[model samples]
Target: MAYQTFRQEYLQVPPVTRAYTTACVLTTAAVQLELITPFQLYFNPELIFKHFQVWRLITNYLFFGPVGFNFLFNMIFLYRYCRMLEEGSFRGRTADFVFMFLFGGLLMTLFGLFVNLVFLGQAFTIMLVYVWSRRNPYVRMNFFGLLIFQAPFLPWVLMGFSLLLGNSIIVDLLGIAVGHIYFFLEDVFPNQPGGGKLLRTPSVLKAIFDTPEDDPNYNLLPEERPGGFAWGEGVSWNC
Candidate 1:
């Protein structure tokens, strides 16, 4: 009964969000069960290129430390913003969304070479939040029920919160950089005078991931509400 209900709800989540979030949760659970360790997950260039441990590239973005306050906080933000982006602006464009993921992950991996950061899941989360906020710049956001600001500042606000928590700001900054790069290339640059679309989703991805418009069985999710939340809605930070 409960399991059936849970399965139905889970299936309702947009495909990209469902797959990515499920991977993160399962990776964490693997760690919790002692089947995996952070040592095996953290990104290491030497192992990746020299010894060919390629899975670390993806796994590093999966584990967000142990299952506790920090884990829950990151997961909430990740799932929330990721889902909002998919069902809102990127709705019916699964291939492009997946392309964005590949693009952002590639940029982060390149940048990770110069930084001392281990895991990058938080940065990836920030990139999603950043992109969504840029697309919905007018939406008001409330941080911790205290500070209220426009959507554009949400990434910085999260960075500020990270600083307050004694976490390195580097990760947040990395996310913001990659997010800005993506937003500018995809949204801003193409609209400028004499500027053309710089980011194009490969046709292969489209063929593999995007559903055909002529398909009679295709069902699109309902359009998301403004800001991905109701007006006057409070986003509680339980940490």
Candidate 2:
């Protein structure tokens, strides 16, 4: 029901999102006035997470680019993809964005930080996962008029491109972590859907995997066939 939820959430777009857009504009203006740097809270997790920090929950999304054209283009993309997601779920999905972005991003960030502090530099982990998302597993990306791998390729593509060429997205691990965690707990957390913990993880993973029509990752949608929802057909949050 990912797609159905998407439709519901889309109808309920959050007010905070618009406020965020305004805040982004205001921040840019402030920076232009030499009041503060654009990257002010890019790395200060504690400061970013403090109370009244609602903006922090959504700021990273505000950082389009400094240039007019690029920023506009990115905004269009954000509107297209993100808005589709928001609209797909209904009107309230924007709130879910805040939840997912914060929850998921934070989880990934914590994992990366933990890995670095407790283990080793594993930036490639994030990079690789992203690179792989550009395919719809069933369809291809429409690149310059040519349909490439698959539409589901977006998540990995965006992830990989960001890690490799976008920026040294060490901070992004935070975003990624929160995302998967939310995916894990979203509909069936605290209370197991499969009745008990015996199949909790797999069942939850399967739920996230199975999607309705308008899911963000097209590839994650259920296959085209006469049948009921199949858990194994969708993307399972592995690692």
Candidate 3:
């Protein structure tokens, strides 16, 4: 009975989020079981371009190390914000969400070529959080009950938290940069005087991922008001 309930709830997650999160989990599990090594998964340009190990491009963003605190933390944030974004602003736009994933992943891969960082899964998670926070700027968040701030600052706060954990901030910064570029292109710039849409979801993706639905009454989830709780300590808040 418990397993059945779990399966039902898991199946309820939006498609993109469910697939991405499940991939991350399974990839990490494969590593933990010694079915694969980090060398096969990390972003290595030489192995990818010369040896034709192109799978590295996507696998590099699938593993988040072995099962531990870092893995659980990243997985939680990844699942939470990814679901919120898919069900909130991108509710009816699965194709566009997929395009955003591709765009951000491609940009990060390009940046990875210059940097020595491996396993971009965490950065990708940060990008999701950053985008969601930007779109829901009015939502209030509490960080471990120690800090209270608006949504826009969530990404920076996570970066700061990473610093406190003795981890490199470069990954977080990269995610923020990519997230900002996406937000500016998709949300901010188009609203300015004489500005037009710069980032468009390719028709191929739309045809492949989107279904024809003409719901005149379709409405996005309403933004949650301020005074919501934090995401730390295993507590999550809706935004």
Candidate 4:
């Protein structure tokens, strides 16, 4: 019964969010258990180019350091905002969400080459939060029940909090920059006069991740009875 309840809750999460959160958890657990080392997962362009350790490109965004305060903090933000975005504006649009991931990852990887940053998981989480917050500007958010602000200010608020924690704001800034670029191109600029859509979800991706809309037999919900009553309603149960 306990396992069944867990499964029900887990299955309630959208597919992309579930997979991303699971990956982050497993990666952190692996580090905690000494099954993997941070050096092997961090972003190192020299090793990536010389030793051909290309996995660093992807793994760098999976581990948020050993499980602790920072790791837990980042994981919470990542899971919450990612799930909200998936279930909100991006609902039933899996392909576009996947495209956003790929686009952001590519841009971050390119920037990581120039910076001395190692793990980018935190920055990636910030990017997710930034995008979602911008898309839902009017939504009110409270930060640890301390500071309350509109949705769009959440990322900046987090960056400020990181500064207070004595952590460098570089990673957070990188995330904000990349996120703004994506938002400007995908959501903002496209709506301006003489502007057009710059990001397009490919046909192949749509075919794979998006459900078809032309299913003739598809029923979203069961049909109701012809009248506002159920069959045999008049024949009440006899005690």
TM-scores for candidates 1 onward, in order: 0.90, 0.48, 0.91, 0.87
156-203 per-residue lDDT for model 1 (tens digits) = 999999999999999999999999999999887888999999899999
Q: How would the candidate models be sorted by lDDT, starting from the highest?
A: 1, 3, 4, 2
The residue pairs that clash in candidate 4, if any, are none
| lDDT scores in order | 0.88, 0.42, 0.86, 0.83
TM-score of structure candidate 2: 0.48
lDDT tens digits by residue: candidate 3, 1-239: 99999999999999999999999999989998999998989999999999999999999999998899999999989999999888777877899999999999999999888888988899999999999887766667888878878888999999999999999999999999999998888888888999989999999999999886677656433434311122233344432
Better of 3 and 4 by lDDT: 3
Better structure of 2 and 4 per lDDT: 4
- Stretches of candidate 1 off by over 4 Å are 213-239
The C-alpha stretches of model 4 lying farther than 4 A from their native spots are: 213-239
True-structure lDDT of candidate 4:
0.83
Which has the greatest TM-score?
3
Alpha carbon deviation, residue 194, candidate 3 (Å): 2.5
Best by the lDDT measure: 1
- Point out the higher-scoring one by TM-score: 2 or 4: 4
Better of 1 and 3 by TM-score: 3
Any runs in candidate 2 off by more than 4 Å, and if so which? 1-16, 45-61, 68-74, 90-98, 105-140, 163-166, 169-177, 187-239
